[model samples]
Target: MKLSSFAVPILSASTAFALSKLPRPHRRAPIVHDVCGSLNSDLILNEVIDSLGRATVAGHIEVCLCLSDVVKFVESNIVAQEAVKLLGDHVKVEALISGMITGLPTGSHCSYPDHARALCTDSNPCDFECTDGYLAFPPEKPTSCKCPNHLMECDGKCGHFKECPSKAPPSRRGNEPQCAAGRTMCGIPGTSTGQPWKCVDVTTDPTTCGGCLNASPFGNAPVAGVNCEDIKGVIPGTVACGNGRCIVKDCAEGFFVAPASDACIPVPEYATVDSNQQSGEAIPGSAGSIEGPKVSRDELTAALKHGAGIAIAHFGGPVGGLKTPRDVTSGIQHGTGVLVKPVEGTSAGFKATRDVGLAHGAAKSLTAGHMGAFAGTHGIRGVDGGLIPGAGTCAKGV
Candidate 1:
């Protein structure tokens, strides 16, 4: 090819003059012969030769030979030569020139870390080649083929992108339970039984089949009106009796029904007084005491109907209003009652009650005059009572 135009200006005239002064042959050897704009080895070789005209003493011939040796050096590096060959005749002159001077990657410069080789060949348009099994890179440069996700490099397969392969978890037989927690409990898959009996299934088993040390395997027991023949010692009125056994049933009346041993066990009783009841008991009391006069079912029903109030005397039982009035005859003369409580995150108890009472009074005032009357007893004055220190618009009365 026409290699004349691609050649860079000869070394500075001063440099050339200095070089020429060195006896015949040559002296300052081109220790590293890297040229730009030249791809073909022959052309590159020619450039070096032309740069060092032949006409010197025999002793300095070593200089000429040394200069020539650079050519062999460039050529011997199969990687660099192949890289240059790949660039071909289209290599950019400026890039080729700069790369030759710096020994770094230029446009189209490929890198082969294995061989540590870089080469420049054709530089007309720009072209390079390589054959040292090195990665094809740009001219006079180094580049790497790293994995996309920083995982690994492509497997030398062109058109293939680099990636990380997924690793699968080890597999185990189906019948064997993986005991990551403790021990495996599995059963034969093809067997008629559902699953092999195991301790792990008991206490944790919601099916109630049986497990847990305290549980019984009494099997399915009908609840009500069903023949309990299969059950032997099952007494009347007990959850455990359905399984042919007698068990105590705790009654809310502060007594436990003990059919197996007969006789009712009394619950702990406490003393209390009702403000409204005829009995002269004190407030805050508990159940199960035989202190008051024997109350007949009729008398209790009648007393409750008359709006007789029941207060927990002395015992500090939860405060509440009567829900149902019992006819003492049925058993006890009391019913359920809910105590006052703050929703949550509330500190003031009596204050909350007071405020709620006030609100209720206000709302009640809208419909019935009873609120005003009740408010008077609670030490609540009307809004018109005017503001006062340590009190709302209306000060509490009693």
Candidate 2:
């Protein structure tokens, strides 16, 4: 090999001056090795020695003994004589140099995390290399590999790119319920019977499911006991707070529905008598007390058909409704028109009792064109919530 054919591309004169000061025993005097274009070639120990007269030339060789040529100049003293064997490595110049100079990988896939270890091929290039799940970064210097997508590095291995792995739970935005005024019920993830979250229960919203909200458990959660059954098909007659928590009250035996009080009250002659029924017991202008047998459901029904009104004279019986709901032959009515507290929250208000002042004289008859004209001479006479027309005796709202 012609040693003169090699060239160095040194960076600074000072670097070359510093390296040229090495002792060149006897083969020279004060060896001010300029390391410029010079003449010095020798073939000894079967190892070739090239000229190191220049620390900076033009071609492949960089500093006098750059890493690229470390393997070629192997004679123990040859490094000291020909070049600064290895400029950067602290190891002995003799050990650092090798005879093999095969370059890095040339194909893309043949590349390894270590550029020097990568295999060169027609397709793969050894200029850069990165482990799986990582990419070469910084065009200026790609000696290091970085995991993309901020993924965690595990066991010296790069995990999935930047993306987080799926955990046990898929994830949800929040505990928001599926329906308004309801709760969101969630089930365990990845289970056969695990159900998706949905809205349920009136325990959170007394308005829903007829006060079912009252039966709700912790934080108004939906449970099996929360069933609003009583007010079932009661549409306009719908499930109401008839005594609350979907509990509907029944009439005490004989008292039919007064039609007014979604409540049930006692019949006129049941245990006592009102001072209104026609009696000659003589209270003068008063209807007088009735000391007789308990009026039957039929009698009340008949009176209801005859423009007779019923009002809750007083409150407090052991019942919840103002009067108490009765099982009228007519039907149950909604809006009990009584003041009762509902399950707090937004609907915490009162329901007033319906008014029953006079009999229609005839159902909806304004023929009298008078205010008190259709009213019964005694107490309120028109039946509540009923329009018996010519029959005139429907009493309501007891």
For each of the candidates, give the backbone clash count.
56, 52
Q: Which stretches of candidate 1 lie over 4 Å from their true place?
A: 1-236, 240-252, 255-376, 380-398
For residues 35-73, write the lDDT of model 2, one tens digit per residue: 111112321222222485434311122122323323444
lDDT of 1 by residue, 1-398 (tens): 65564353444666888987887532232112322332222223212222268422111101111212245544544533543454442233223333343442332322223222234444321222332233433222312211222222222222333442432322222112221132123222244643232223322222221222231222222222212222233233433322323233434353444435323434222212233232544432346322233444555444433223233221222223222332132221223221222111222111112222221112121111121232222222332332223322222321
Model 1: lowest-lDDT 10 consecutive positions: 57-66
Candidate 2 local distance difference test against the native: 0.32
Candidate 2 Cα misplacement greater than 4 A, ranges: 1-177, 180-211, 214-255, 258-261, 266-398
